[model samples]
Target: MSKLQNVFFPLLAVVAAFIVGAIVIAAVGDDPLFVYGLFFSSVFGTIDGLSYTLFYATPLIFTGLAVALAFHCGLLNIGAEGQLQVAAFVCAWIGFTFNLPGLLLVPMCMLGAVLAGAIWAGIPGLLKARFGSHEVINTIMMNFIAAGITSYLTQYFYREPGDPILQTKHIYEQAHIARIAKLLSPLGVDLPQRLPLNLSLLIALAAAGGTYFFLWHTRWGYDLRAVGANPAAAQYGGVNVARNIVLAMCISGALAGMVAIGEVQGYRYRYYEGFSAGYGFTGIAVALLGRNHPLGIVLAALLFGALQRAGLFIDIFTDRVSKDLTVILQATIILFVGCEELFRQLKRRWAKPA
Candidate 1:
């Protein structure tokens, strides 16, 4: 019954969101059915569309897992945005500065990204452990600091000479990850040569599997969840609450940093300023809708990715409806999911003896 509810409620929320979205489309004097048909068909009807959707989903998977891990530790990690940004900068720095072979440079850049993100996130974690300062405030402040610092560093050191763009030099070919199109060529499945889907999708899948294993099948995960559920009880049971807090955030940040592998190594091959179109923030909604499970996160990320792809078609094909309708639908889904606990409480209250 609980498992059924878990699936049913999210499905309910998604359906509600679409219903509301259809109403909005009608208000705009558009044919909601036609618009939605185009939207869905564009995302799933073609191979190129599916590839693009998966490419967009890749980073969301990383960020969503990052948020889910921190939530398991009773922490809200809003700093994933900053963590990803700094990690991308470091990855780009290593990619452009090094001339090593692909085998060596790829892992080297990845390690740099992970370490940079972990360290940046560790500061707030340490503060929360030592001073009892709220991680939320500290993480939010860290985002601003990270943005300013990265911006200054990119302008001062990484930006190409006389180039107005605040971005690093293009990474060498040695650091590039092969695109999905090339990989599938051997199987005779022809994909668009320029599709952005790449090897990082595999990394995202691996991270999800690793996260599931770490949280459910490991002793450390046991300790972490114990601390999250009840810190006093966990401390009485000999779990070091403070240490777990810091450790969880570090792991979360490391996962978030994997976004760099997709953006820098896989697609753009450089650190572009403002490349993140709120993927970190959107990840909160994804995690909530997914109920913090790896399989659910994958499904939720794919939905959002499809919405993103569909929004473009809506703009081009619909006369009255704009892409903002997609934003409204996303917000509605978040709202319904966020209120789920309240609904559960109401149901319980109404069912009580009266």
Candidate 2:
């Protein structure tokens, strides 16, 4: 595929999904243009809206990159959901239990999250490498295991006394990440104080940049990609295929773990039960739409983040259309992108040979 096709294909998929969405809106007795305007405005019109979009995008960015990294290694890491859950729990556990100063506690919590996620994901990776088991099955099983274990642990050990909620105690203040609103107050940009946008956004961006560098510019990345392209060939060429497989998953899990920084430390300040809201699964869509590139992932994450932020307004403003329309649109985009090969074949059949 050409560079133009790389950029054009995803954009075409997005436009096609929106076109279908507009038709659905019209069928529901609403003006498609008006509904779309409301959607766009709610996500991008004001500072609060944009901040919320960015806040939502932060986790998607991490999870998207995580999936992309594994995808590059010819692996489907469906366990990102589980990995992130475990990581969030570990991070929250550290935050609530530790009494260190801000500088010490924050990084320690992050490290805990990363290690927890890596270990959770590494099990499936090890299974795939050592036992020749399929990662997809193992990762899916791990998601369920992670969910059950985390729920049990939270209820048994961390639940606030007599509260009846499945969540940990509130984290210490020093462990909390500073919200971007507060950080910008000194610079005269008066963002909404309540918005969840935080320093984690910068961390997410840094992760993207680092991923691009690591994947395309480093020797280790080449070996990983080589293993993905052809494990037998890579091994014949002296690359350690098994090691790279495990390493790829470890790195993927670490990236997914970063989501906890935004959700647990930055916003909730607790490990709330079932707080994921499907960010990990949505990340697969984001990674596919982004073509597994860091820059593309950021843009795709922002688009999905905006859609999430807009869903509430769509529910309130439209008569017959519900927030479920966003789900439909997302599904449509995924369908179209996944069928790109079919479209390309049809295009080829219609074109003259050079």
Candidate 3:
């Protein structure tokens, strides 16, 4: 395929997915046009809608990058969900417990979250590297451990004092994120009060860029990529595959953890039960759809974010089709993407002279 063809792959996948979605819509007795119309409007109708989509896209960027990082090391990270939750809880605790100046407090809170996330993800990496354990099994089990530990911390250790709610106390005023709504108010846009977009969005973008530079430019990333592509060759080349695996997993976990910290610190300013809402798992799909490229991951996350932001509207406008259809769409996209290499090979064969 030419460069143009390579670039068109995602667009083609989206078109194919939508065609399948139309079939699903027909099967569910709804008008596909109306459903798609609702989707486009919800994502692009107004500045408010676009802001919501961007806000939703923020954490997805983190999780997608996390998964992409792990993929580069030939490791599948399925524990981002738990790592994010734990990091959020830790960041919230720091933000609330301290009263330092914003300059000092912000970095401290962020550092706390990153460290916690890395540690949470690093354990499985260590086990896999040292003991030759399968990362998939170990990471899955570690997710359970993270969940339990976070649940306990939230329930007892970090629960707000004298509050009936099962959530932490609000962070310091200075720690609260500046909302995009505040910025849009000057432009005469009346955004809904429901969704919150914060400064962490900038952080996520920076992380995405950093991920790209690291993967494509740095020597360390080269080593990690070498290991990912061929472990035996990398080992023979003395690249320390074990160390790279653990480090890559830690980086991936840190990104996931940053999602929660960004969300809570910028929006809620508190840790609550069910704060994540399955972002980690969705990130796997996003990474796959993006082909593990930093830019691709960002775009893929934006697509999913738009879909999620518009899902409720789809349900409201077309009651026949359930909101779960968005999930179905995401699952289908990932499944198809998984077979992308096969499709490429087939296309190559088809183009060959008879």
The candidate that wins on lDDT is 2
TM-score to native of every candidate shown: 0.95, 0.97, 0.92
- Give a tens-digit lDDT track for model 1, residues 1-354: 499888988898899899999999999899989999998799989997898899989889998999999899999999999999999999999999999999999999999999988888888999999999999999899988989999999999888899999998999889998899999999999888899999999999999999999999999998988988899999999999999999999999999899999899999999998999778887887888899998899899999888888989999999998888887888899999988876688678999976
Rank order (by lDDT, best first): 2, 1, 3
Query: Per-residue lDDT of 1-354 in model 3, one digit per residue for the tens?
Result: 466765577667777788899899999899999999999998999776788889888989999999999999999999898888889888988898999998888888889899888988998999999999998888788878877887787778778677777787788977766676666678997666556877788889999999999988999999999999999999999899999999999999999989965688788888887888689999998898787888888899999999888888987888699788888888888776777776688779899966
Candidate 3: TM-score?
0.92
Q: By how many angstroms RMSD does model 2 differ from the true structure?
A: 1.6
Model 3 off-target regions past 4 Å? Answer: 161-165, 181-195, 345-354
- Clash count, candidate 3: 0
Best-fitting candidate, measured by TM-score?
2
Model 2, 253-334: lDDT tens per residue?
9999999999999999999988997888889989999999999999999999999889889999988899898888988888
Which residue segments of model 2 deviate by more than 4 Å?
A: 349-354
Instruction: Count the clashes in each prediction.
Output: 0, 0, 0
Count of backbone collisions within predicted model 2 = 0
Clashing pairs in 3: none
Q: How displaced is residue 159 in candidate 1, in Å?
A: 1.2
Ranking of all predicted structures according to TM-score, beginning with the best and ending with the worst? 2, 1, 3
Q: What are the per-model C-alpha RMSD values against the true structure?
A: 1.9, 1.6, 2.5
